[model samples]
Target: MPGSAPLTTKDGRFGYEAAGDPASQPLLFLHGIGGAARAWRGQLDFFRDRYRTIAWDMPGYGGSAPLPDVSIAALAGALQDFLQAVGATNPVIVGHSIGGMIVQQWLAKNPRTAGAVVLAQTSPAFGKPDGDWQKSFIDARLGPLDRGETLVTLAPSLVNELVGDDPDASGMDLARDCMAAVPGATYRATMLALMGFDLRSALKAIAVPTLVLSGSKDNNAPAPMMAKMASYIPSATYVELEGVGHLANLERPLAFNAALDQFLKANVTATQVTA
Candidate 1:
């Protein structure tokens, strides 16, 4: 298990965990609303030998500062700053859930910046934030907090519902720990932020090769929706891991890593013969 002390920007606005050499082509990871930078440990450990692995604690998570306005656009702006700060030029970007949405927003605005992209267990849109389904979702997550259940107290049961029937024990523990650390306010703000995201129109404009990773058992971002999303991207490869749910990376690291590794080799590394 490769790991390191989490690092923060000198100004204290951004925080992340980095492993491997900065000289290497970067492998940047973005975790879901329920997760923090450490959720990417399995990936950092697996890919650090060949790529510079870095995982950010999205604004408001970990030591990162909370945004005055938590929107996709704002997150993307922060992402740009983080990239510039860390000197991650045309990095191979991997984003999961809300992280995936942020990546889409970043690519939508800065189309040519990434060497390749990976969107795992995410959707193109949340539909109208006020719509019935969306409201239900927002309520399901926030209702607990509204009733005074903090993220730390709600994390265990929340993670249990997110994982597959049989998940990796250590991975489940890691996922729980990550979820437990999320700030309650951050979760609320991010949930509302998700309501405003709609990136379907920008999918075809994705400039780099893309990997759309889905989990067959994912109810949050269903497999069918992800498949259709892949169809919209110009150069997209779709891979669905069976028996896994929304937390595919933590639910089944081997299958998730294999899909990611293959995508990087064919779409990113092959292009980066320099690395």
Candidate 2:
């Protein structure tokens, strides 16, 4: 990591572990729910020399302080503040799953982004929970955790579907640990905020270069949904990684990184060519 430091903002202080060249373009990573900045270890390791790679624990997760306010907009604001606190201006953001939705919401409130990579995010509004899946997800995850169920014990079962099948034993444990570390209230608040979010209308308004990556077998945020989101964004490029679920970046890091590197290079080059 080029610079490892703690970030302090008006809302709270955040710990960010960074790796890469200080002079390179900054790339900010936002992990999914139950995930911390460390979730981007693979990415940071790969891109460090070429780009300034930094990932931080969001408020109420990992090393950051708890945030009682859990609204999507509030989360977005906190992210924005964190970015400023860390001195990343016009950064390229890569977000996975719930983190992806947070990026969308972040852009909605403040669209001055350099670029974005949205991976396997659910719809802005998860829409009305269908069948028992929604309620079941809530009951199994949010409800128990809120009431004092062991977060570590309860997190894996709740997000098992999001993780691809055939995850290595070590990878599975990492996922569980990340989820467990998140506070119960934060988890519940995030889920509730996700339930009512509908960002379809806001998509077309985004003007930055964007990439939407989908996991071919993701039940949590299916390919069709990512496609729908792509259609709404005039500048968005959509790609589906085969044989992976929601966590494509984690499940298939090499392929995902290759695609990402290509997209970012092409986009940055085109911008320079046009400029």
Candidate 3:
């Protein structure tokens, strides 16, 4: 999806890659902490002819500017700014991992901002900021960087651990490349950002069609967690991919895209939904 140089927002605070007709319905993809916009090549290509498909690099990744304060709310504001700059309206957003968290936060404020959303491989809460699970999670991600190893060196192992039982060879390679490109500092910031996330209460307030897609093998955001999350959202539909892991979109892109496309057609494009 990325061109020779990434496309920047009017304020130059965000960078994104886009395809398809700009005047068409907006279909934006937000990558996880380990990924940049280029990681969404499959999604961009698949939806390019049908919608204005755009994939964005989170602030501080790729050509996007870094945020002074990194919180779920701040990231949500950045998302709004980026979409506005690109003239995207009534968008159908697909968010993975932390990207999903940002969508939840954005909807918390602007309940009707999106026409529909897919929250894939994500959770509503991370326990507590200073809890053992939170600490261990952050430590695990940042430990290698602290030991003087770069993401380039650790990407192979990290990606290996995140994939499912069935994975595409090319997708695995792209996942590694995206993880390797992530700056260590931004990764650390985002990991810490997860500690403060507790959007369980906000789930019920979302006023748009939502898909809570999960992987049975995703220990990070387990299937049960996603199912419970779906139960909380009034308009949510839950779907779990068997034998899949945390990186469902990358590992099982075909299935992931199928589920997402089906949800969009049923709730958004093929039907008229109020946003």
**Candidate number achieving the greatest lDDT relative to the actual structure:** 1
Per-residue lDDT of model 2, residues 158-225, tens digit only: 55767665654655666777777877767767777666567888888988888888877888788887
In model 3, which runs have C-alpha deviations exceeding 4 angstroms? 1-5, 270-275
- Candidate 2, overall lDDT? 0.73
Q: Write the per-residue lDDT of candidate 3 for residues 128-217, one digit (tens) a residue.
A: 878987888889889989999999999999998887797888899999999999988998888888886898988888889999999999
| Top candidate, metric TM-score | 1
Where does candidate 1 stray beyond 4 Å? 270-275
Clashing pairs in 1: none
TM-scores, one per candidate = 0.96, 0.86, 0.95
Summed backbone clashes in each candidate are 0, 4, 0
Worst 10-residue lDDT window for candidate 1 reads 266-275
Q: Candidate 3, TM-score vs. the true structure?
A: 0.95
- What's the ranking of the predictions by lDDT, best on top? 1, 3, 2
Q: For model 1, how many clashes?
A: 0
The global C-alpha lDDT for each of the candidates, from Candidate 1 onward, is 0.89, 0.73, 0.87
Q: Could you tell me the C-alpha RMSD of candidate 3 in Å? A: 2.5
Question: Which residue pairs overlap in candidate 2's backbone?
Answer: 1-19, 124-197, 125-197, 125-198
